[model samples]
Target: MALNYDEIVGKFDKYIFNTYTRQPIAIKKACGAVVTDVNGKEYIDCVAGIAVNNVGHCHPAVVEAIKRQSEQLIHVYNLYYTEQQALLAEGLVNLTEMDRIFFCNSGAEAVEGALKLARKATGKKVFIATEHAFHGRTRGALSVTHKEKYRKPFEPLAPAVFVPYNDAGAIREAITNDTAGVILEPVQGEAGVIIPDDGYLGEIREICDETGTLMILDEVQTGFGRTGKWFAREHSGIKPDIMTLAKAMGGGFPMGAKLAREDVAANFGRGDHASTFGGNALSCAVALSNIEVIKKEKLVAKASDLGAYLMEELKALDKDYVKEVRGKGLMVGMELSIKCEDIVAKARECGVLLNCTSDSVLRFVPPLMISKEQLDTVVGVINEI
Candidate 1:
């Protein structure tokens, strides 16, 4: 009376949509940075659910919070307020000077809300995003995503202009009077952890200031201490007009938020925009627990230290297959000399779970709580590959 991999895959193929070419591994149980398949083979989860498990899987504090909240008040809609949501909002405001917050269900919804805020506040319809960007799949967020594969089917997408990423001149040139907002990931996560030039964010801030455009930072994959600092742009000492956050915010629970300056946030009044399950009590409890654990455990500082160690270890593996390793905090990327898919597959055999970004770059976004020994294991796997 047990489940097998074949049975699981057959059920999924019948019921699930044919979108992602998923691996054949069926994860049965997970804890910390490791997941065990149904056959009891363990693999280090270097992907960390694509950076959504910043604190690690089934963190005790997060689990306790979810249990307590479900027993107390599980699904209080955003229409009615709750203490957990208020506390989370206050913590966020204290964390950043941003004024208002809109809680949503995922990264895509957060991007959607941010764009709506920009358009509503500026009274403009056009958005400027960077090429090779991957925001989300929703209609509003998808419109601004610059990848053709993600946008071609949904053509005539919301009058969005695609600019080259990391080019300040091109971004400045693209800023017309009609531009409603400019959105870009501080370090492009899906675009291969692409770090812009040192002064690029400040340049963007200046441009947004001069052109009267709302600056939006898509921190979906980079926020919640992945980038050493709380947010990657903080490294540049630049403030965005609106910043969208998700991924690690909920510690695996589906949650996202758009943070904006108070006056700018005020543009949307009663029912200007709404979501049915947007700030539900359960998500708030989970998100709060995630943040609490991050702070209590000082995982941010750990990310800074271990990330440095990981980088140093990776660079030691500089071989013909290895191209370059660059990262800030736990968010690292390895630009391979060749396509990295097989290398990743080989690493999976070596008891590690890493992912490839684009076709050539290998992305390393492990949990912020990854131990030095675990990182050493990662290095050994790379050496095997």
Candidate 2:
């Protein structure tokens, strides 16, 4: 029998690191857009594992792929090439429109790999990042991250200059002789789902081209079908020199990768970077299945259609506290004048899961496959609350 919520919490308090400020209820199982708590209460999962379960929880194809690959082989290290790894590499390269791939374990590792590649490729040390941008939590990724609370604990980080988001002039001015590249999230996820202006990314691309600096797009949270397109960068039609991906890559399975253009990727020789379990057979198989699920279900287009409907519905919310409702697709955010934590808790009580980020922004990153009725219910619950 499964342990009850109290039992789980007791074990977690004793064994787990106190890193995350977790939600109260303990999840038992999930299918598609819904998750059931240990008390057998079903909640519409708007969090979607913080945008990792894009294809939805326990997607049949992904589950099958994991099972099949685990039976055949799991990890064989990076010394030898595997068919699953090769296939996934080809798929990701084609999807990302990049020339090369470096598999890693998570978003932070992908950022680390991208940062190192940028420095090695350009023979420079500085990286230009934007304010309110969140890449990851590792040392190198943390340096580019803007929040003082996350950065203050670890000082003397790698060389990176911060610029304001959506301001191309600041980026242009920040580029220096020693600047290796500019790392940015096409749609800033952790910063209240901030979307850039139409011309913002294109202008930055031009500035990077003019200065001979690499453009590194961190699509960790915005990749897959989360932002209407396969990538948020697609909205701007700008190709980044190097790109980092992770969140929804494996469809809830942990995996990440760094992609780079042909010329830029050539700088990383055989021994320069490697990960023991980066592209293990199990992860690659699951990722391949996840990509196939996204394509087969036409989830990209669905996200576009549903995102429009969701935005319209959110904009019609009765609450005067709603300051703004903005997003590209499923990755929508409702900015409220008041802190949204209480609302999040209330939503959970109403059988809907929600996430509050940046204090006042309620982020809504539901599954790409969520039904319109389900979305309406989610919005209605919030409205009632």
Model 1, runs deviating above 4 Å: none
Instruction: Report the C-alpha lDDT of model 2 over 220-280, residue by residue, as the tens digit.
Output: 9999989999998899999999999998999999999999999999999989999989999
Off by over 4 Å in 2: none
Write down the worst ten-residue block by lDDT for model 1.
72-81
- For model 2 the local lDDT of residue 119 reads 96
Show the colliding residue pairs in model 2: none
**How many clashes (backbone atoms < 3 Å, residues ≥3 apart in a chain or on different chains) does model 1 have?**
0
- Could you give candidate 1's per-residue lDDT for residues 152-269 as a string of tens digits? 8888778998889999788889888799999999999998988888999999899899889999999999999998988887899988999999899989999999999988899999
lDDT of 2: 0.95
- Local error of candidate 1 at residue 259 (angstroms): 0.8
The local distance difference test score of each candidate is: 0.90, 0.95
For all predicted structures, in order, the TM-scores are 0.98, 0.99
